[model samples]
Structure formats: C-alpha cells, structure tokens
Target: MLKFRELLVQSLLNDKDEGEEIEDEQDVPIPRKNAKSTHIMKKFEGNARQNRKRCISCYDKLQKEKGTKEARAKTKRVMTYCDECDNKPAMCLECFNEKHPSKYF
Candidate 1:
C-alpha cells in the first residue's frame, strides 16, 4: 500500500508537470462513484488527539456556532471549541465574539 500510494502521488506530480490534454472524441459522462464508509472506534476518548487538531481560535469558534460560548463567562455561555480558529462555530457566541463582537447567528 505504501508503494502504491507513492506511485499514485508520483503519477499525480508527473501529471502536473505534463502540460497536455488527453480527450476522447466521443463525449463521455463519467459516472461519479460514491462509497459509504463505516468507522468504529477501538477506544473512545483518546487524549483529544482528534479535537486538539484545531487551534484555540478555531476551537472557540466551534463553541460559538453550537451556541455554547458567551461574551463574559458569568453573563454568557462562552464556547470552548475556539471559534476564531475553527470554521466559525455558527451557533456559538464566544467563538464569534473573538472576531465579530455582535454575532447574530
């Protein structure tokens, strides 16, 4: 699999270098293939290795999207996912306030 992946990557890189187009005369509608993946966790709650992947700002933003965070800890329920870093936690306020003080969503 390692060698296979390497070959695939090399082929991709080579393709980028080759500035040529290969097309068929007949128009062909390529059928898109979608595969469903099933994931199972062998161990749950692993040192946040997955969650820690995001920076503090993103973490807070995520919290805001979820409506988890607030401006002041005492007055508002600030988010924890660091919205500023995450893709802007839409529901969490704490994350939004980091960038946009008055976040409506």
Candidate 2:
C-alpha cells in the first residue's frame, strides 16, 4: 500500500487532477476539467436547492464591483468570479490591505 504522504506526492507529480479521471471498469473516461465543472455544478445545485442568497456584504460588493458609471443598486445580484483569479476567494492587495492587516495575507 502506498503511504499517505507518498500518495499525496504521487498525486502532485501525476499532473492530472484525480477528479478528472471519472471512469470505471466500463472504460468510460471524462477529462478533469469536465469533472471540475461537474463538482462545481453539484455545489451550485445544492446552493440552489437551499434557495441561497448572497449576504448583505457580498451583495453590496457585487453591486459596487459590477456597477457602471451610472452606479446604482442593482436589483439582481449576479454571482461572478474574479476574472483575475478565477474567483477563488481572493481580494486584490491594494484594496484589501487598507481594511485587512498585511499579517492576514
């Protein structure tokens, strides 16, 4: 049996995401990008099932970030990912630092 750490190292070196190898003895195969999409879709499904809505802060942030020059409170707050970082819970340092201490980074 592969040791846990060895397995992790193997995964890192494998260069392929484990989620991408969606297959079985049936010889069916799906690439990792599709697998990642499936995973995200499932999470979105669950969120939809719960009728989730953005928090006040998140809603405000969306409005501010997406607002045009006319800048008004938008009735629909569409969830968007950060184009710069694939929206993985990131804040640009220039804006984040004034509010959040550098140590948090």
Candidate 3:
C-alpha cells in the first residue's frame, strides 16, 4: 500500500516536470472582456408596493383621539407609500390624498 502511494506521488510530480496540463474535474471558462451577457439587466426601482407599513395619518388621528400610549399600541398598517414625501411616510389612500393635494387641481 505504501509503495503504491509513493509511485502515484512520483508519477504526478513527473507529469508536472513534463509540462502536461492536469485537467480539473470542474473547469469553468473565464469570461472575455467584450463578452455580451445573455440576461438583460433591468433598471432598479425603489421598494415594492406590496410592503406594509404603519399609516402616519392614522397614527396621528389615533394619538389625538386616544392618547399617545394607546395610539402607539394600536397603529394600523397600510400598503400606500409616498416616495416624494420626506422620510417616505406610509399612509392610507384617503390620508395620502388629504396630505398631498394636487397642485394642478
């Protein structure tokens, strides 16, 4: 068993000395500089609309109606968000309309 191991090691060293390239089992090809990718890269937009967050208007209304403690404990979550607003406050459709009235209208 020892002699067989020694012969295998000697043969591998000899192969390196002979300048023969030893093929790897998983040989991945290196990408060229001018190579065009198959997949198309899409423009990255902001966060998805599906994300739910606590409504700021509803929170304020709750705070005004039932004290800050109760309002904090029972704030409602909504899907609507305003990217234009500072800090991007999440709000319901009614609240969004009320807060941000159309300048054209």
Report the number of the highest-TM-score candidate: 3
Q: Rank the candidates by TM-score, best first.
A: 3, 2, 1
In candidate 3, residue 63 scores what lDDT?
Answer: 95
lDDT per residue (tens digit) for residues 1-105 in model 2: 224444457677996576775234345333333322231211122354354333333445666888643233443323322232233332233333333333323
Candidate lDDT (C-alpha), each:
0.38, 0.38, 0.63
lDDT per residue, candidate 3, 34-76, as tens digits? 3232222222245655466678998999999999999888988
lDDT for 41 in candidate 1 is 14
Clashes of each: 29, 1, 0
Model number with the top lDDT: 3
Residue ranges of candidate 3 with Cα displaced over 4 Å: 1-50, 103-105
| TM-score of each predicted structure versus truth | 0.16, 0.19, 0.45
Q: At residue 18, give the lDDT of candidate 1.
A: 66
CA error at residue 92 for candidate 3, angstroms: 0.5
> Residue 45 of model 3: what lDDT?
46
Looking at model 2, which ten-residue stretch has the lowest summed lDDT? 35-44
Model 1 lDDT per residue over 11-89, tens place: 7788544655544434434432321111111222345444333333554545676544542232322223332333533
